[model samples]
Target: MTINQAIRILDPDTSAEALGEIEYYGGLRGKEKVLVACDEACRIAVEIMRQHLKE
Candidate 1:
């Protein structure tokens, strides 16, 4: 899948500016890209949960 598709799948709320800032992973294949996206998404989710728990 393309970066745009991956971002939509991983975080639909992501802004256009954020999308522009994201570095291209030219070396990664489809599977690697998906894995990386999932990993980053999970990390972001965990951070959000932690912030909520603190409040």
Candidate 2:
């Protein structure tokens, strides 16, 4: 499934761990961490949406 759409990257579940380095650095846990990461990743997606809306 999709996680970060700006990069059009899917959530690869083949990793050894679900939690990544960034979530650890952000001091987030579980669903909170996922939410935070999704929010952060959406910045560019939001910008692109805005650009399309203006066009």
Using TM-score as the measure, which candidate wins?
1
| Ten residues in sequence with the least summed lDDT for candidate 1 | 17-26
Clashes of 1: 0
Q: What is the C-alpha RMSD of each candidate to the true structure, in Å?
A: 7.3, 6.0
Cα lDDT, model 1, residue 3: 48
In the range 1-55, model 1's lDDT, one tens digit per residue, is 3545445656657634343334344244645654566677666666768999999
Residue 43, candidate 1: C-alpha displacement in angstroms: 0.4
lDDT, residue 54, candidate 1: 100
lDDT of 2: 0.52
Q: Residue 40's C-alpha lDDT in candidate 2?
A: 58
